[model samples]
Target: MNKRIFSIGLALMLGAAYSLTAFSQVKPETLVKQRQAAMILQGKYWGPLGGMAQGKVPYDATVVARNAGFLEALSKMPWDGFAPSTKDVKSAALPAVFTDTAKFKEAQDRLQSEVSKLVAVSKGGAEAAVKAQLVATGKTCGGCHETFREKQ
Candidate 1:
């Protein structure tokens, strides 16, 4: 009967919806992928600024402001992905990221703080100050990687 077919279709739809909701919650591999994607984006925004700070790339205020803004936002994206669930996931993060939890958090805070400063400095359009902040931010990144990330 038409009613029976309709009921079956509704049940199937409900089951599919439930399955989607279940899978939408963060999984260990998903968290790892999210953090890695955030890091990759951070690098994409940071590379040019790093080159400028080192005098390899010519500094452009427009690019600096744009990239700094992107960096500031990206900096906050990775920390939650470092959740305990991700500990068993294979990632570029080293054991220290879980073992030295306090240190890892401090490094995350440092990167966020440094990128915030870079965003502020870039808005001022002062080339020297922006470049200086870029170096400082890059060092914050390097310091964290030295302690927490696996070498590529």
Candidate 2:
């Protein structure tokens, strides 16, 4: 009975240690993929609103509000994945993302700030302001991409 209890405890301890190591040492490539996924989702939410601002798509306030809310959430996701480990990973992110750390962080903050403003403005039901904010948000994204992302 004691031997069985000891075996069970040993198995549980080994499982916990393995879980910690697996989660704590996430592969750099995986991190890059996660960040990219977050950015893609951000674009998915932002594209329609951006198109509306650019006159390519018809304006829809309901959609704007929904996407703005989504952007606010997504904007917070990608930054952590730009860890030092990912600096060595081959991705669309430029070297500036790691070398120009302050600028990269500033860009991240700008995106989050702009998205937050968009979320707030969207809730106000002001179409013109929302459209303007969408343009402003797009500019933040473009500015960051110009500095930190490779050209498509």
Candidate 3:
């Protein structure tokens, strides 16, 4: 009787392990959630950086460089998830994103470029340049969000 119970437990454990492995693979909804979560994290990082740039928070080189670097990294994450096919999935992404791919991609690329500039200025520790780059980066964010993302 004990052996039978042990066997059943082992089988159940193996089954659960297999299920976990299968769930780890990327799916359409998974990609959408991953990108959305990445964007949310980026927004968290943006708050401090924006505060510094807007003079609401004191300038700190370490904080600026770190957050700018994080934003630069995040700038590359959403593109892969925005696959032509994933556009139709249950996401806040608008259908226009698939139809107007070029314009949308251009906006995404522009944000990346601006984020790179922000990273460089942050490293240089130039207050004025960082402020200007922040404005540019914000514009890129607004432009892309307005054009590509849904109103919600």
Candidate 4:
């Protein structure tokens, strides 16, 4: 009885582990949806903010603060959600993301870091500084998109 129970327990454990491993692989359709959602949100906020920072549009601290909040939320997204499989890459917003994983990761890190900096600048009580940081952050966004995003 003891031997049979132990064998069953071990099998269950191994099955659970395999299940987890399989779950870590994101489906191609799911990845495409996620990327599309991320891009839309990013565009909604970053495009106007970039214009404001560049002086092509009037700067509004309130808008900047609101957009900064969105960016903070976006920065927290798990990069691992993007699976590295060939099928996932084929459907990815930027197919090159698969071929240049290291560069993509670096760009993602830069984007997150710049977003944090932008948040700090927004709350630091300096208008000019906030604008400058916004520009810097916008550059990082553009840098990543230039390499990873499909031109639309």
RMSD of 3: 6.2
Count of backbone collisions in candidate 1: 0
TM-score of each: 0.83, 0.86, 0.77, 0.74
Best by TM-score: 2
lDDT by residue for model 4 (15-101), tens = 999999776765766666676677678878888888888899898888888889898887656465466653344443577777888
lDDT (Cα, 0-100) at 45 in candidate 4: 80
The candidate scoring highest on lDDT is: 2
Ranking of all candidate structures by their TM-score, best first: 2, 1, 3, 4
Residue-level error in angstroms, candidate 1, position 113: 1.0
Which residue pairs in model 4 clash with each other?
none
lDDT of each: 0.89, 0.91, 0.83, 0.78
lDDT of 1 by residue, 32-135 (tens): 99889999999999999999999999989999999988887899998888888788888789989889999989998999998888888888757888888889
Q: Residue 18 in candidate 1 has what lDDT?
A: 93
Query: Tens digits of per-residue lDDT for model 2 on 1-152?
Result: 69999999999999999999987799999999999999999988888998999989999999999998888889999988999998888999999898999998998889889888898999966888888899999999999999889999
Residue-by-residue lDDT tens digits, candidate 3, 92-117: 78888889988988998898999988
Looking at model 2, the pairs that clash are none
Over 4 Å off, model 2: 1-20
lDDT of 2 at 66: 92
